[model samples]
Target: MAARRHTTTRRPVLAAAAAFLLPPNPVAAAERLAFDDLYSGWSVMGASFSPRLLALVGQEAALRGYMAPPLKAEADFFVLAREPMALCPFCSSDADWPVDIVVVYLRRQAQPTDPGTRIEVVGRVETGSWTDPDSGFVSQIRLRDARFRPL
Candidate 1:
């Protein structure tokens, strides 16, 4: 008669166990925000940004929206809107820019999706009025170093 013993590797087991000890970051990952959550209220003049939205500035966040038509088929930036729009949000004028729209500046040029295609974007949230130097596009809210995928 004979007896056999089995052995298991410790490295993998130790690595898996170590992961549990690490603290989780509340904002380590992008937080999902809704179009409706962008503003606090509306008026003939304009809407105000909600405290929650303003508080997210400089933090990574995600937004789901439809891509507005871009100035070029492949461009470094585009506008995202709550609903599909026939024209770029900044095409008309700054005053006409919708509160529900957010300018998305990509890490690199990207082929914008069709106007009707829904997409989700992740990037650093930026708030405050700023104008693009090249296109002369004006925006109050923006997502910088962003990436998007079809929804």
Candidate 2:
């Protein structure tokens, strides 16, 4: 018996099929939890991360959401929102996103996704308060060194 090589046609077909069958990956995927499941409580002052979220800190999390407009024309960080925000959370001093938003810090600047495009963000969850020194925006929960793409 002789060894044989695979054809390129089969390789492309297999690659395409693999892309569809697999869930969207961001950095790496861990146990998936919905945005609704991120917080156990929501309030004006702040929200508490659900035990599920708190327990997953420093672990990868996959959160599905839309990309909100960044505070600056360019930002090191972006916000993933459950819904398209009509107002700017940073520009509009009174505006604020839901407590569950996952503040995504991309390894590098990524082309902003469509506001309507649903994206999956994955990164190590950081649970606590932090302010963006450049923007002064406050966040209770964030996903550091995150990456995302349309779902």
Candidate 3:
């Protein structure tokens, strides 16, 4: 009897399965930003965004920080701060936001987490002064269409 010959054909099947299971590549990776890099100069009058920050406007970016309290229980927007804020500036007048704070406008409404929890936010960087029509909250810089994940 001739020795049995077996040819395995599983390699291609395995490769195809891997390709299907893998996560799709993002259109573009977000540029990581540090709070210290948000500004070139800061004063009582106002702050000037760093050249790097300015150049990144309209581009996808990521910032790691604490998420300040939201205006409502379920909201689409929140504030990202280097530290936990004493007050939710967007919802209060007694406390003011830090110059380097970045407003985060999420793509969908979400239940906010504790103020102390650190988070990483991803979105398109938007510069210049603007006020939210609904809340009348003024912001110098913001992350539009943003989303966040706990750190």
Number of the candidate with higher lDDT, 2 or 3: 3
Model 1 lDDT-worst window of ten: 1-10
lDDT of 2 by residue, 1-151 (tens): 1221244235446545655788634323354557877888878876777888898899877788888877676656988888876765567655556656667887677788788888877778888889988888888788887777686
Report lDDT (CA) for all predictions: 0.77, 0.73, 0.77
lDDT of candidate 1 over 1-98, digit per residue (tens): 12211112443354355445645322225666788778989999988998778989998888889888785567788988998876445677645655
Candidate 2 TM-score versus the reference: 0.74
Relative to the unseen true structure, what is the C-alpha lDDT of residue 48 in candidate 2, on a scale of 0 to 100? Answer: 74
lDDT of 3 by residue, 83-125 (tens): 9877644676644567677899998888897899988788899
How are the candidates ranked when ordered by TM-score, highest leading? 3, 2, 1
Superior candidate under TM-score, 1 versus 3: 3
Most TM-score-accurate candidate: 3
Please, what is the TM-score per model? 0.73, 0.74, 0.75
RMSD in angstroms, all models? 13.7, 10.7, 13.7
